[model samples]
Target: MGKIVVSENVSLDGVGQDPTGEEGLRFGGWFGQVGDSDREEWAKVGFAEALGAEALLLGRRSHEWFAARWPSRTGEWADRLNGMPKYVVSSTLADPGWNNSTVLRDDVVSEVRKLKRRVNGKIVVYASGRLVRTLLAHDLVDELRLMIYPFVLGAGDRLFDGIGDRKPLRLVGSRTVGDSLALLTYQPIRDAGA
Candidate 1:
């Protein structure tokens, strides 16, 4: 079975929305405020995660967002992202334009469960907030890694919002990436006797 790893760049206040500013969100583009050195170092962290993953699982919006940008870029990170097998979770996506892509349009829980059984290594979800919440609700994610930035966006949509149940996390690892971000790795601690 494959492990579902959720990797995201989030602010100190837990805001995870529109870091890139492409979505026209109110707090969008906050991610770019960091210095070049910080950004450069964070890229290494992101690249390492991509290199370690066997595939990518994304929400429709995220899939579309990535499809629009990564294909035009050229680099080791872009190469890995563009080449990996991608699973896009959407009910309306008739065709996934990216190569090696599959669309999961119904019963995400069941389809993703099957996908995990078939995959060989890590299946990662990157900054797909809606998808991440769904995975967490269903107890689908095996690992959660957050690169927490120093600044806080008080009003933006958060990464862990709308979770109906409280899930405890087991901290596995942590480190400071560059000057402003903290990389934290966790695993959901299943309920007792569950």
Candidate 2:
């Protein structure tokens, strides 16, 4: 069975929106707030994670976003991402333009469950906040990896904004990356009575 890992870059206040400032949201570009060394370390962490993932799962918007940027980039990370099997969950997307990309147009829950059974290794998800919430609500996510930046974006969309219940998680790993980033890994505690 595959492990559904939801990886995200978030602010100190848990805001995960507009990290690249492309959305034009207020406080959008928190991703570049740190120094060059810190950014380099963060990139290294992401590269390592990408190296370990067997496939990528994303929502439509995230798929479009990544497809637009990663296809033209040249590097080990970009190459890996561009070449990996990508599944995008969307009701409207007819064609996924990125390389090795597939559009999952069925019921999101059912499609993801099928995907989990089909994949043997890690299916990593990135920058798909809505899909992450759905996965969490349905108890589909196996691991949550968060790279927390130092800034506090007080007014942006947060990671856990619409989760219906208090899902408990057990901390599996944690480390400080670069000067100001906190790399935290968590596994969802599936038992209700724990």
Candidate 3:
């Protein structure tokens, strides 16, 4: 069975929105606040994750965002990301412009379940906050890999917003990436009685 891993870059205050300043939010571009060394280390971590993942699960906006940038880049990481199977959960998206992309127009939960069954390795999710919340609500996520940046965006959409219930997780790994970033890996405690 495929393990659904939600990998994200979040702020110290749990903000995950507009990290790249693409959305033009007030606190956007928090990702650029860090130094070059920090960013370099973060990129290495991302590359390693992409190398390990069997497939990518994304939302429509993220699909569009990545398709605009990654397709033109030529490198090992870019090649892997562009060639990997990508499933975008989008009802309105007619054509996923990215290579090896599929649009999931049906119920999100059921579609993800089917994907989990079909895929053999890790299905990594990136930059899809709404979809991530849905997966968390339904207990579909097997693990969370959060790269926590040092900045605290006092007002913005957070990573854990709108998650109605208490979803418990156990920290499986923790490390610092460069000088300011914290990489945390957590596994969801699925068994309520455990």
Candidate 4:
């Protein structure tokens, strides 16, 4: 089985929303406001993961957003994401224009579970906050890779807002990057009952 890892950039106070006051409390470009060093460092990690994955999983909103942005970025990372298989979870979006994209219109959890069984490599989920919450709730995420920045935006979309229950995770890795962001890697704790 493959892993579903959420790679997101969040503020110190846990806000992951828009900090520029454009989309109300939505964190549309929260990470972009960070310093270049911090941004690049995260990009390095996230892009590496994206390249290593067999496919990219995204929600409808994130699919539209990344489809517009990542395809324009000319780099090895961009090529990987643009060329790799992408599975999008949506009820509305009938078609997506990002190179190798597929819409998953069936039951979310069941579909993801089936995908997990078939993937031979990683499944990276990027910047899908609402989808992240749903995956967490359904035990769909095998791991969570969070790039925690140092600054806190008193208010914005948080990373863990609608999580249903407290899921146990084991920290597999942690590193501080250029005194700005902390890279935290965690895998869900397998329950004894399971």
Candidate 5:
């Protein structure tokens, strides 16, 4: 089965939104805020892993936000994400503006399960707090790759809000970048008979 991975750029204080108090609460490029050579390398590694993914799962809001920006980007990472098949969970979005994008109109868990069965590579999820909470609640996420920045935003969206259940995860990797960002990777431990 393909792994469902959540990769996000969050803050040290568990804040994932408006870290820089930028417009639209985007944090003014949170991922690239404190860029250095080491941080750049870390981003390259993360983006490369995302490029290897067979599919991308995004929330409706994220889909629309990215579709408007990434498709016009010229970098390799942007190209990869824009070109790969995307499964967007949405009720209002009947037609996504981006290419290689599909709407998930039914049950999120069931549809994601079906997609995993059919794919042969990684399924990457990025910046979808609601969707991330659903996957965590349902025990569907296989891995989490978090790039924790140094800044702390007092308010914004978070990935762990409203989670109902708890599942143990094992830390498989950890690295610190020059910009004080901790690159953490965790894998969910499977329970017996699960």
Candidate 6:
């Protein structure tokens, strides 16, 4: 079985919004706040994560965004992402428009549970703030990989907000990427008698 991995680029204050700077949020372009030296390192991390995934789990908006962009990109990372099976969690999206894409129109959590039973690798969820929160709230995420940026955008969308339940995560690993960004991996600490 595979684990549900919630991976995202977050700011110091846990904001996961507009990392690509194209989301049209007020704090769009926050990812560019990082220096140029980290670009290669960031790409390496993204590539490794994408290639390691069994498939992708994304929200409708993110699915559309990636569908519009990644196909035109030419690189190992792009190829991997373009080829991977993408399971989009949405009730309203009829056609995902991305190759090898499927829409989960039923219960998202239950469908993800089935996906976990079916796969033998990782189900990586990236940049879907709403989907991430839903997974976290339901205690469905097994791993949380955060690429922490250097600054705090106090007024943008946050990755860890509005999750009404408590989900304890234990730090599994930590490293510095390019002298500025911090890569943190955490695993959920399961409680007995669930």
Top-TM-score candidate index: 3
Give the C-alpha miss distance for residue 54 in model 3, angstroms: 0.3
- Tens-digit per-residue lDDT, 114-194, candidate 1: 999999999999878999999999999999999898887888889999988898898999998888779999999887443
Candidate 5 lDDT over residue span 1-194, tens digit each: 88899988788766666534544664444655676875777767777886779999999987887898888888888878888999999988989999999999899999989988988889999888889889988888989988888776656666676887677888999988665778899988887343
Off by over 4 Å in 2: none
Candidate 3: which stretches are off by over 4 Å? Answer: none
Write the residue-wise lDDT of candidate 4 on 1-194 in tens digits.
87897887778888867644456654455656668877677778777787678998998988998898888889888888889999999988877989899999998889899989988778998877888899999988988988887776677668899797898888999998655889889989879454
TM-score of each: 0.96, 0.98, 0.98, 0.90, 0.88, 0.95
Candidate 1, position 22, lDDT: 81
Residue pairs with colliding backbones in model 4 are: 17-27, 18-26, 18-27
Candidate 5 regions off by >4 Å? 19-32, 36-39, 192-194
Tens digits of lDDT, candidate 3, 1-194: 99999999999999999998988998999999999999999999999999999999999998899999999999999999999999999999999998899999999999999999999999999989999999999999999999999987799989999999999899999999999999999999988676
- After superposition on all C-alphas, the RMSD of every candidate to the true structure, in Å, is 1.4, 0.8, 0.7, 2.3, 2.6, 1.7
Clash pairs (backbone) in predicted model 5: none
Local error of candidate 3 at residue 149 (angstroms): 0.6
Please say which candidate is ahead in lDDT: 1 or 4. 1
**Decreasing TM-score order of the candidates:** 3, 2, 1, 6, 4, 5
Order by lDDT, highest first: 3, 2, 1, 6, 4, 5
Candidate 6 local Cα displacement, residue 74, angstroms = 1.1
Clashing pairs in 6: none
Candidate 3: TM-score?
A: 0.98
At residue 29, give the lDDT of candidate 5.
Answer: 49
TM-score of structure candidate 5:
0.88
Give residue 91's lDDT in candidate 2 (0 to 100).
95
